[model samples]
Target: MNGSLRTILAASIAAMAMTGVARAADVPIVPYVEPVPVGGWYLRGYIGMSNQQLGKLDNVLFTPGTVEFLDSGGFDAAPIYGIGVGYEFNEWFRADLTGEYRGKASFTALDRYDFNGDNIWDGSNDYSANKYEWLLMANAYVDLGTWWGITPYVGGGIGASRNTISNFQDINTPNGGVAYAPSASKWNFAWALHAGAGWEVTQNVTVDLGYRYVDLGDGETGDIVGYNGLNTVNNPMIFDSLTSHDVHLGVRYAFQ
Candidate 1:
């Protein structure tokens, strides 16, 4: 072959080989994404702590011609458990239906009454009273995503509650001291409002903390009269309205 032709052919072959190598390098061998399932229905179970307080009431009992007294401090703390069904609307928002059970919480109070206008005291005056309550609820929520690993949310619901009063003891009084014993249980309609946030510890598991305020309607406390071997006096009374402020910490699992 002529020198000039040989040199041109050799240079052409070298360039073609270089181009093949460059094309192969530009083609990616692995994709750059992860697979995640986004929307679905999920069920969550939770348990946490709660604190409750009861509101004040007047003329608790309609005891004619006498004054009634109730202990103002009816606050308690206990464990709470619940289950919920939820729907994920997107990455930022979701809604849920929840119901919770709170164990029995109780407190004691004293009730006293004046029977007659007699200057000489003679009546059964003192009695001991006990109170307790339970709650059920449902709510909706908004997930605020995450900062480090924490997610925040808010929700509300309506439910029913039961209040009970028992264990009455008669107190000594002048006017031949009257013996009075009273106990009753009542169910009432109620509602709850709550706001809280949680932390995702893993892809499918979360730890949540929150606060809720609830209102349980008023109940009736019947007239008090003598029971067993005690003097009798009938005075009407009503149970006051109830409320609670609860702080809770719990765990949740998401099916992804």
Candidate 2:
């Protein structure tokens, strides 16, 4: 090719390359965006404290007017630990299955009896025991919208509770009496209502702080027997309307 023709072609190629560079610099660059997941499975663990209550005590041996309570039965506060597996369907909904162990709580009460319908108390007995529970639940929750990486939620659960009564004693205040009942466990219907807030700690981790009101049905002891093998009763003592209010802290790890 001629030198003049070659030089003209080279200039044209360099001008096209410079124009391409200028256009590239003028075009805007898009910022990187993080994607949100639609749904996921998660594992959770929790620890909590429970304030327990017992409505009353019942015994078949005690007639309506013949028995009176000097002190109503009640339970002390207890600690709780739990683990669960869950599915988060969206930013606003989730469900889980949980199992928990409630630590033992001390129980106390005092009562008097009138064998004859005289309305006068013949004698009194002081009751003492310890109780614990194992609870399993299926729960669903509706999460309110997130604000500053924290989401509040409300939920409910239905399940079963294994309530246990142990170390039950009836101390006769009139005499130095020692009557006792064996440890017993009963399975009962259980339910709970939950309210909480979850704070996002990482991309796949959330920390939860919550409160729960739970109904654990009833708990009971085995048949009553005297410590000296005398004056045994045929009926068990029942703890009616067992319930609790709980405060919990937990963490959930989502599988992405």
Candidate 3:
């Protein structure tokens, strides 16, 4: 080949290489993006303080002309703890299964002097007991729209409870006082009404502060001895109602 022909081929090759480089430089680079989480199922834990009420204490002796009457009854506040699993079915509705433990509460009562039938109502038969409950519930809630990442909610639940009454005693106040009604466990229907707000800490985490009005039906004691030794062992006292107003703080973690 001649020098003219060789030079012309070299020039064409050089132009093609430079054109390829220019095309590469014209392409744009894309920045990488990280993934974000969303909600589905969740797990929760909670703790609370309970202001409990023990309704009237009923004695079998209060029936007919039995000579026993309830003068007064009261209860002390207690604590509670729970755990649950739930599903979020969109941004407005959710459901959960929860198990809870209510700490023991103390009770007190007085049986007045109806035994004398004088209608003066004078003597003191003192009563005391400790109660606790194991509760299981299925609940549903309506989550109002999120505003500033805070969601207000209302809900309800129906369930069962194992209520226990322990360390119960009835002091005669006359026979130098005595103990009656041993420990006993009973199962009952339970229900709750709830209102609360949830604060979104992140896409997958939340904090809840709430209030609940719960009803635990009733509880009772074991056999009663009446005194140190008596046929009163045939009787057991009943706590007519067990109810509470509760304030709780909780945390929820959602699975994305």
What ranges in model 2 sit over 4 Å off? 1-27, 32-34, 231-233
Q: Number of backbone collisions per candidate, in order? A: 19, 0, 1
Backbone clashes in model 3, listed as residue pairs: 224-233
lDDT of 3 by residue, 108-217 (tens): 88765556665765456888889999999999999988899999999999999999999998787765778676789999999999999999998888999999999999
Off by over 4 Å in 1: 1-30, 57-70, 111-134, 168-185, 221-223, 228-237
Strongest candidate by lDDT: 2
Residue 210, model 2: Cα distance from true site in angstroms: 0.8
State the lDDT at 93 in candidate 3: 89
- After superposition, candidate 3 runs with Cα above 4 Å error: 1-39, 64-71
For residues 22-93, what per-residue lDDT tens digits would candidate 1 score against the true structure? Answer: 999999899778876665676777776657665653443435556454455454566777778777777677
For residue 119, give model 2's deviation from the true position in Å.
2.9
Which model is ahead, 1 or 2, in terms of TM-score?
2
Q: TM-scores, in order shown?
A: 0.70, 0.88, 0.81
Worst 10 residues of 2 by lDDT: 226-235
Best by TM-score: 2
lDDT of each: 0.66, 0.94, 0.86
Model 2, 1-256: lDDT tens per residue?
9999999999999999999999999999999988877679999999999999889999888788888898898788899999999999998999999999999999999998899888777889999999999999999999999999999999999999999999999999797778899999999999999999999999899999999999999999998888886654588899999999999999999999
